[model samples]
Target: MYTDALRAEWTKLRTSPGALWSVVALAVAIAGLSALAVAPVTCPCATDTTKLTLTGVQLGQAVAAVVAVMLLGGEYGTRMITVTLAALPSRTSMLAAKATLVGGLVAVAGTVGVGGAWVAGQAALGDELGAGAVWRPLVGSVLYLVLIALFGLGVAAITRNSAAAVGVVLGLLYVAPLVTAMVQDDDWQERLQRFGPADAGLAVQATINLDDLAISPWRGLGVLALWTLSALLLGGVLLHRRDA
Candidate 1:
């Protein structure tokens, strides 16, 4: 049953023109922008260099999240969600299937985006790309995009409106950092970086300065994962409890 549902979800995604174009746009934008961002500078620490090179992930994630949110949000806008729920007859199972499909596709596309970014950064920045310390940043970047997509899915499930869902997801992912920048004290800024979702999550891509890093690489990724999973669980609860 799960496999059948998965196939059905896949069919829906492929038939949607937005899905393919969004994936292509995401891959190109991330790779191209990251290469440009790191082209001019070299860092003493490899981690810093890697971080600069992967900066595009910070932007690309929002795009992936938007795409993910649209998967469900579009359905709701057109009142197709009711048809979907009726056809599947198990709302929870249908949502699970949708989430799995969206997550898997986003991960694959994100891999391309991040991989292209890493390679382009290496070529454009040379030593600035950070030698052997590349893998974590590369893998972490892909995971970051995937997580953003999942986060979006959860937001869309709860909100059920394309515009509002997109707004909520983007606000959660982007606004916190902007607000954190307004903090006056150095201590407060560092504390926020250590705890904030975006700052803490990006720590996974750090390949150079471990001692100075605000959080451990694994822990940083875990923080983002925690945020993503919590949102998903919350969305699932709302999805099961609310009307289609």
Candidate 2:
């Protein structure tokens, strides 16, 4: 039954006109923009190298979010969710199927995009970065993309409106960093950085100057995981309790 539901969701995604473009865009945006961001740097720019690779992620995540939001939010908007629920009967199972598909697609896109960014960054640089140091960041980057998509899915489940969910997701993801940046206290700023999804999740990309960072790499990712899990659990509860 679960396998059948998964197949159905995949069919819907493949048939969606703009869905292909969004996945492509997610990859292109990450790799393309990261290359551009890191193009003019030299060897000593190690920290900058890792940081700039994230330009793609910052932009690509928005595309990823839209892909997830449209899965359920778009259905809600068109009242197609009723048809879906009637067909499936178990909202939890349906959500699990969709979530699995979203994570799988995002993981593939992220791997390609991160690989592209790694090549582009190396080509644009004056020298090679240590492969040993970069591998963790690369792996972490792909996982980060998957988490971001799931985060968007949870928000979409809660909002149940594509327009509103997209707006809220983009606003929080983009604006929260700015709000964190505008703070006057360095200590407080660092504290907030440890909690901000964008900041902490991206911390896993750090290869140099680890001691100076607000949070350690793995722990930062754990923080984002907490945020993602909370969103999913809350969304699941709402999906179970609320009227379709």
Candidate 3:
């Protein structure tokens, strides 16, 4: 039954034109932005090359969020969720199927985007990137985007509204970082930077200046994972309790 539900969700996503295009857009945006960021670096000393090369993840995540939201929220908007629920019966399995599909799709797109960004960086920056520098950001960037997409799916499941879910996820990703920057207290600023979803998650891209970061790379990614998990848990509870 669970496998069947997964197949149904996968099939739905495969058939949706918007979902298909959004995945492509995610890859393109990440690669393009990373290349653009790399092209401007005349002095590598002024920038963290690893972070610069993977900068596309910042913008690419927005598209991932949109794709996740639309996958479930589109069904709600079109009154298709009711039919989905009727067919699946078990809301838990249905939500799990959706999350699994969203996570898998985002992972594939992220791998392409991150791989493209690394190739672009190598072309623009040459041998500046060391052997130790390559693997973490490359692997972490892929995980970062997958987590962001799951975060979106969780939010959409809770809200059951595409527009609201998109807005909240964007604000969490983009605006929270800005608000964290504006804090007068250095301690609070540092704390927020350590925990804020975008700030913490993006820390995974920093190959150099590890001591200067507010949080460790893996730990920062952990913060984002916590946020994603919390949202999904709340969403699952609400999804189980509420009607379609």
Candidate 4:
């Protein structure tokens, strides 16, 4: 049942009218902003230039969220979800299939876009960086993108509205951290930094000051994984209960 659903979802996603274009948009958004950030940097300085170039992840994630939202949300919009539900029967299988496909596709596109940014970062430095230095940021950024995509898929499953899902995803990504920043209490700030998805998740890019970071790099990624899993579970439960 799961394999069949996976195949069916793959076929549907591949034939979606906007699928190819959306993937292209994601890559371009990341690569374009990253290249722009890399262009002006005078590297080999006493700062984390890798993180600076990775600023594109901030803007590029919006596109990733939209692509994922549109995957299931488009079905809902067209009332094609009814057909999908009927064909699959098990909602869990259906959602899992979609999530797996979305993760795979996003990972590839993210790597291409991030690879360009990394190369630009290398050239800017006028010296080659060890794999140790480059691997963390590069791998973390790609994983971050994948989680963003899955997070969008989960939210879309719950909301079932493309615009509303997109709005909610973007709000949590961009606004939660903004609201956290307004809190003046140091302890509260640290707590928020550890919890907010964007705040905690982006910590994976930090290489310069590991000890001084509010949350360690891997722990921050764990915080994001928690957020992503919660959304997926809630969406899955609601899906199992609600009528399609």
Among these predicted structures, which one has the highest lDDT?
3
Best candidate per TM-score, number? 3
**Tens digit of per-residue lDDT, candidate 4, span 1-244:** 8899999998987787688688877878787887787677664566677787777888878888898999999999999999999999999999999899899988998988888777766766555233236688889999999999999999999998999999999998999889999999999999999988889999999877688878988899889888889889999998899999
Give the range of the ten consecutive residues with the poorest summed lDDT in model 3.
125-134
Q: What is the lDDT of residue 214 in candidate 3?
A: 97
Clashing pairs in 3: none
Q: After superposition, how far is residue 37 of candidate 4 from its true place, in Å?
A: 0.6
State residue 136's C-alpha deviation in candidate 4, in Å: 1.3
Model 4 has an lDDT value of 0.86
State candidate 1's TM-score: 0.92
The digit string of per-residue lDDT tens for model 1 on 47-124 reads 467777777787788888888888889899999888888777677777788788877877887888788887877786
- Residue pairs of candidate 1 with colliding backbone atoms: 47-208
lDDT per residue for candidate 2 within 1-244, as digits (tens), equals: 6887898898999998798788988899899998988877666644556656666888888888889889889999999999888888788888889899999999999899988888887787645554336777988888988988888899899999989888877876889889999999999999999999888888888887889999998898888888888878888889989988
TM-score (C-alpha, index-matched) for candidate 2: 0.95
Residue 205 in candidate 4, Cα distance off native in Å: 0.4
Residue 195, model 2: Cα distance from true site in angstroms: 1.0
Candidates ranked by lDDT? 3, 4, 2, 1
Position 39, candidate 4: lDDT: 78
Show pairs that collide, candidate 4. Answer: none
